[model samples]
Each structure stands twice: as structure tokens, then as C-alpha cells.
Target: MKSPYSAKIVQPDISLSICGYSKVLEIVSNKWTALVVYAMEDGVIRYGEIRRRIEGISKKMLTQTLRQLERNGLVKRVITPSVPPIVEYSLTRLGESLLGPMRVLNQWTKENYSLVEQARASYDQAYYEE
Candidate 1:
């Protein structure tokens, strides 16, 4: 059976360049972008909530990352004209589409974390400890 998460493949077009792939990587590969996306997986959330959920993310970085995600059309920002002026953020349909691959990547990281740690230890022992 075909995997539900598997993307449909189209015939390769040699006329098109790989530049778009690099641009996407530049957007999603930022340090906080993935985490921000993951945080929104639950549903709509406020800015403070996102900041609190993502530990170690400074106000500036979170603000910048959110703006970048918005610019990329991956996230939506909503504002309420209440007395306190509430601001909320949520993943757009485009952003939701990314969750499948992100989940797979997250699982791979968890499964290989120990092996990665071992490699790091061996590398340090071979180089830094010598």
C-alpha cells in the first residue's frame, strides 16, 4: 500500500532549476522555524503562548521567525480588537501540509539521537582529547 504521507512524484523537468528547493530550505531550516511550526500543530495560539512553549527563544528571534513564516505564506496572524488587543497565530493550509514531513523528521531524530551522540563522543575523543 502506498504511504499516506508519501508525496506524489511528477516527471522531472530538466528545464527547471533546483533554486526553489534551496529557498525553501533557507526558510524552514532556520533554528526556530521548525519548532515554531511544531508548536502551532495543536491549533491557534497567542504570541506569548508560542514564546513560552518554545524555551530559549528570545522575543526578538520569535518575532522575526513568526514574521518570516508569515511572509512565506506558511502561517497566519490574527489580531483581535479587544481591550488588550489579542494577537494569535495559526498554521495556514500550506503550513499544515508540512506537518507530515516534519513529523517524520522528528521521529528520525529521536530514533537516531543516541547514535548521533555516540558519533559525537567518538569524534571528540579522536580529535579534541588527543
Candidate 2:
């Protein structure tokens, strides 16, 4: 028997999938990646400063996130030949291009998070009452 609520599933066109949304999300969806990008967005910064700016991120996680960003061409790392070899991180042109969209999403979240919380609360209340 067919359910009334069941709807036909349609696959998205491959042409509409530019660069693969999942591939991009896989890179940016990590909890630490966005924070790390925002940390260096202001200017070139050292590894230690990035770790300090983002609270609760472990050293290992920070290192991994930086490497992933670098690997994706979104972040650039420069090592100065010094007695201790100073390393700095900065956003490349590609990374800077992402800022505009990210800012829009950030603004949307800031504006709608309260509404989302209210919806969640209402849903939970009704769900529990049932």
C-alpha cells in the first residue's frame, strides 16, 4: 500500500552541482575550520595566536584544521627561516572570496537563531505533550 505522505524522489542534475556541494561542505563543515579561517581573516597570524583566539580547540585539532585549509588552497602558510623557524598563516585570494558568503550566512544565523530556538522549543513541547 502506498502512503499518502510519500513523495517521489528526484535526483539533482549533475550540471547544477558545481564543484560538488558535499565536497565543499566536507572541507568547511568541520567545527574548527571556520573558526580558524575567521581567526586569520584579520591579518597574517602565527600558529599560537590562532590557538588562543579559538577557545576549547585542542592543539592537535588546530594543527589538523590548518593543514586541511592549506591543502584546500583556502589558506596559505609561510615559514620564515629563523633560529626557530617562524610560521604564519594567512588567507589566500580564494579564501578571501569565501568571506562574503560566509558573512551572509553568519548574519542570517545571528538574525534567525532565536526563531529557530523558539521553533525547537515549541516542537519539543508539543512532542512531549503528545
In order, how many clashes per candidate? 0, 0
- Candidate 1's displacement at residue 124, Å, is 1.7
Question: What's the lDDT for residue 129 in model 1?
Answer: 100
Candidate 2 TM-score to native: 0.83
Best by TM-score: 2
Question: What RMSD does model 1 have?
Answer: 8.0
Each model's lDDT: 0.92, 0.90
In model 2, the runs with Cα more than 4 Å from the true position are 1-19
Best by lDDT: 1
Tell me the tens digit of each residue's lDDT in model 1 across 2-46: 795596658655432467766668879998999999999989999
lDDT of 1: 0.92
Query: Which lDDT tens digits does candidate 2 get at residues 44-129?
Result: 99999999999999999999999999999999999999989999999999999888878888999999999999999999999987
Clashing pairs in 1: none
Least lDDT summed over 10 consecutive residues: which range in candidate 1? 9-18
